[model samples]
Target: MTTPQDLLIIAMDVTSSRDIGQGDLSLALAGAELVDLIEAGALTLDDDRIVPGAAWTLDDALLSEAVSSLVRQEPYESVEDWLWRRGRDLFAAYRAAVEAQTPVAAGRRRWNPLRGGPAERADSPARRRAEDRWSKGDPVLVGLAAAVGIEHPDGEGAAPADEAVGTVLDAVHDAETELEAVRQRRSIENAAFDNIWRAP
Candidate 1:
């Protein structure tokens, strides 16, 4: 399975005390896509900017679309910019794709560990592979998961050996932090509004 797919599965499979925010997952998913593209030789990172590589075919439809979405012109998009632009509602897209691939019963909602429901996917090879990677603490997967607030089972994961991959991971963390700040600001504003309304 691809990195983004594995990451999505991991997010869905998470049994964390709190639900992973959709915004956080979307940013992490974008970062996973970039990491996979770099591995596939579809792109490279020049500092923080993405430099698209030679034309290539990706077997995965979503990944192929990601390639198509790359900024081919010079001064290509920075990893941080790409994460925000491509990550918009990315969680919903991946969730729909996974649900499409995995069949569900007529009336039952798929079990999500975070949501506490019945299991959705059967014991498939893809899932087993993702689980194996998570269990072994694959650096890239661990990094992306951590950005979205999912800690490794054995604490923090080691940094990836690949410099480019590490760059992408760092971008994901920065973007997630920025998003969280925005959330906090909105929360504070809403609370102030509520206090004003409740004042004597």
Candidate 2:
């Protein structure tokens, strides 16, 4: 039986085919349930499940939706040439990588407000108040906290104005494209392998 702990979720919602809309993917942490989702066809595995010779196929939009629901992470998508050169099985690695990006960095400064942007912590004692968690006494601690905040731009918190979710999904989509292509090519290869392995 598949358990939630064994699998992960890639939740994403892109408005259209052109843009990389914001999304989250947190379901994969519990691999077993995730595997169950995949087995039941409720959630499609990025490249691995999307490929030929697999149990099912997911369209681009649906793929985006799958990417938006769970914890969001930067998926491991290799360049087209790179994937072809590596002879990887599918986009499973990339999808898994991206899905895994979260929790791994959960407590890190990466999730702080103003991700990848300037710090609200450094602007004197008053300014840092609204931004930092380590703002209790100790001038050195405050300074250190400010430094940390400035370095890790927590996009959602730093600039809530920007469409951060969409940006995340777009990245997922881009990675999936290469995985999808590789999947198709692998289909051809798989057929050959099957024919050879099961030869009369």
> Native-vs-model 2 lDDT?
0.29
TM-score of structure candidate 1: 0.90
lDDT of 1 by residue, 96-155 (tens): 776665445466577543456335566667777888899999999989898887788787
After superposing candidate 2, which stretches have Cα over 4 Å from the reference?
Answer: 1-161, 197-200
What lDDT does each candidate get? 0.84, 0.29
Query: Candidate 2, residues 1-200: lDDT per residue as tens digits?
Result: 01111111111111112222111112111222232234445444344322112234334332433333333333533222222322232234434443343232233332211133211111233223322432232222222122112122322223212232223223333444544567679999999999999998
Q: What is the lDDT of residue 200 in candidate 2?
A: 88
Q: Tell me which residue pairs clash in candidate 1.
A: 111-117, 111-118
Candidate 1 residue spans exceeding 4 A from truth: 102-108, 111-120
Model 2: per-residue Cα lDDT at residue 167? 31
